[model samples]
Target: MSIQPGEKLVFGAPSTLSDRLTHYCPGCHHGIGTRLVAEVLEEFGCIKETIGVASVGCSVFTYNYIVADWVEAAHGRACATATGVKRARPDRMVFTYQGDGDLAAIGFNESVQAANRGEHITVIFVNNTIYGMTGGQMAPTSLIGQKTTTSPRGRNPKKEGAPLRMAELLAPLDGVAFSARCAMDSVAHVNAAKRAIRKAFDVQRQNLGFGFVELLSGCPTNLHMDPLSANRRVREEMIPYFPLGVFKDVTANEKAGA
Candidate 1:
């Protein structure tokens, strides 16, 4: 079905599944990112051939939203599950949806190792800086001085260290084919996020190995701010640290010499 501006399309109808109504908080980017993935799967005609691994955090509902074959991984094992799925079903597109805490923290080893091994899978990481599902704890991507339940007095760099730049860290990995960091705070940034998701899927379709997109999403409920203010915080506080751009694009490199 066609979607108009300001129109909220529930997960069903011509989309994919009918059971998965979005449970994300208002202004949370998980819904947008999930919808973009669903749309990309539909566009690529890979709905039946797609397998998604859902991780812990707010994104655990990904299986309910996306109609494709899906499985739930442990708190930080989505990447490992995605790797297994891709290996077993090489013809199918495999991807994992995870959050900052799930990916960059508890799952950091799994993610980095998967990328280092060049696993043929796509990873969509939602970096909201705070742990939303677990009561707004400070995530590994939480900015310096950012306040959270775990860091009520604000994050101290000496204690917690700076937020991890995941995309940049993975850019030099030979196994990584495409890596980008995007935001969903503004209209332009949202569109860019969609493009980044699409590109990661495209790389997977081409069997180009590991592809990752770190999306700077907003967590209004955890941030204890209204939707507008939460978005503004992303622009003012988060973007400076995470930034928004294509950090690595191996697809262009392959085409340049062709």
Candidate 2:
């Protein structure tokens, strides 16, 4: 236990993740977010029983990285796929990893109905604001004045409407057991994201209701910024719009006797 040269390592990649080299760009937050999910799975001892539903977009290739049983769902059908998986295999731990465009724009209905029905599952919504794949197009969650390939002139709320707040939108649903928005812009925020991810799964474990966590991640490759700058953008620009913290938690309310 000494600080000697011939000693054990302090940390290593979580067993829940594959050794495959990530294809994500430098400073991209997907890698960090994926690791957080894998760590949660390992800590919960549910890796062996976990079934991940990967949606189309940059996140579609998540099956290549996470070391778990995964199924590829069409562009925005991840939530429906996860719902079916959970229903068919009630003993398995089911979750979906989705991007902003995939979950908010195209798969919006599925995401809504899943939460509205209080499906016993977890949904990890990664909101980077821009569509990372398909050449960095503007996404439904793209903030006003945020430039993108599709919105080179910056998103105009008058034309496209304001950014969609999925966490805030889903938090009030009657079937939702947990809902929160988190950012991975700093160490403190990363820790908070981990707690939210764990609680989402814990909600499923308790057979309460639908659990959802929307993570405001950074996309340097898509945002046309360096890794560090992308992180700063998340903190400075994204946080004010999306905000971070739990929007709802039935368990917390019950514990507080609310």
Give me the candidate number with maximum TM-score: 2
Best by lDDT: 2
Q: What pairs collide in candidate 2?
A: none
- Model 1 TM-score, all chains together: 0.93
Candidate 2, TM-score vs. the true structure? 0.97
Candidate 2 regions with alpha-carbon error over 4 angstroms: 1-5
List model 2 lDDT by residue over 84-178, tens digit each. 99999989999999999999999999999999999999999999999988889999999999999999999999999999999999999999999
Q: For every model in order, what is the number of clashing pairs?
A: 0, 0
Q: Note the residue pairs that clash in candidate 1.
A: none
Query: Each candidate's TM vs. the true structure?
Result: 0.93, 0.97
Q: Give lDDT for model 1.
A: 0.89
lDDT values of the candidates?
Answer: 0.89, 0.93
